[model samples]
Target: MKDIFAKDSSGEMVSPHEPGYDALIADIFATIKTATEMNTGYRTPEEVHEYMERILGKELDATTTVLPPLYIDYGKPVTIGRGCFIQQCCTFFGRGGITIGNDVFIGPKVNLITINHDPNPENRSATYGRPILIEDKVWIGINSTILPGVRIGYGAIVGAGSVVTKDVPAMTVVAGNPARVVRKITTPGQQ
Candidate 1:
């Protein structure tokens, strides 16, 4: 089981026993501290962006806007692109990784979870993950949950409250639990 999903050098899973676990824990706690500071009070847009940049360890574009009460585990594996807008109360479990491209709009209360717990009860505490990729110009509807390992392609529209478990094709609309393709989009000036 470990060989199939090991993320560390030891060919072992990430748990209390693995290398870098202590530092990972420390980073999580630090993120918690920053989240407490950033989420507590009413902050201006610029302030919000500032704090988010600090948390993400990367500068966000000036045009990009993010509301407060945003949550994350470790910021090391998260990369958000330019001109993105992340709504309030979005939680990112970025232990694996999350890549958000330019001009993406993530709706309120959206959860981008990258942690996939070992299904075996004996090893449930151990986690393996895959990156969640949101391509440019994509719109994720309110309350949607983007599961680990799915790529939302460019110009795709994820319907509200959908649970996306697979890659969405570009210019397509997806909805429902284990989201299915509902429609295909046609761009102007093209057939």
Candidate 2:
């Protein structure tokens, strides 16, 4: 059976005219409800966790600290691991699914976009899903934009204000509009 909503499992294009469109719209509204409540006020860490769980429909790992004013599109396709520190004003378009590994640090105003619309004018209403993966111990800097289908490797660091379009190699530093590799760091005690 085909899932109407854009998820990582399928590369099929999703349009508002699909058969299961009503279910998709329901999820969108539900996510908006939870996101509004969670982002509006001075919610404590515990409260934030609770709201996040409701939004995602799953248990958020312990020790994951998320500041208020976060935005997400379709939270069910997203998975956040333990011990992640997500700063304020981050936007996640998880329609294509997002897998964030443990101990990751995402700086403020970061945007993780997982869906892209078809370029053809007549099919512009249709969108395709491509998952985004962030491995453990990675740090994404402030105002960075990670595009669809990007896999950030472990222990990597993304410099502030970057636009990542491709897979980032492990243990390296990347920055710039297109985000090129700047340097590779040696593990402590190795050199």
- Compared with the true structure, all predictions reach lDDT values of 0.85, 0.91
Superposition TM-score, candidate 1 onto the true structure: 0.91
lDDT of 1: 0.85
What lDDT score goes with residue 86 in model 2?
97
Off by over 4 Å in 2: 6-9
Predicted candidate 2 versus true structure: per-residue lDDT over 85-147, tens digit per residue: 999999999888899999999999999999999999998988888999999999999999999
Q: Which one wins on lDDT?
A: 2
RMSD of 2: 1.4
**What C-alpha lDDT does candidate 2 achieve relative to the native structure?**
0.91
Sum up the clashes in candidate 2.
0
Q: Write the per-residue lDDT of candidate 1 for residues 34-78, one digit (tens) a residue.
A: 877899999998888788888888887889888889988877678
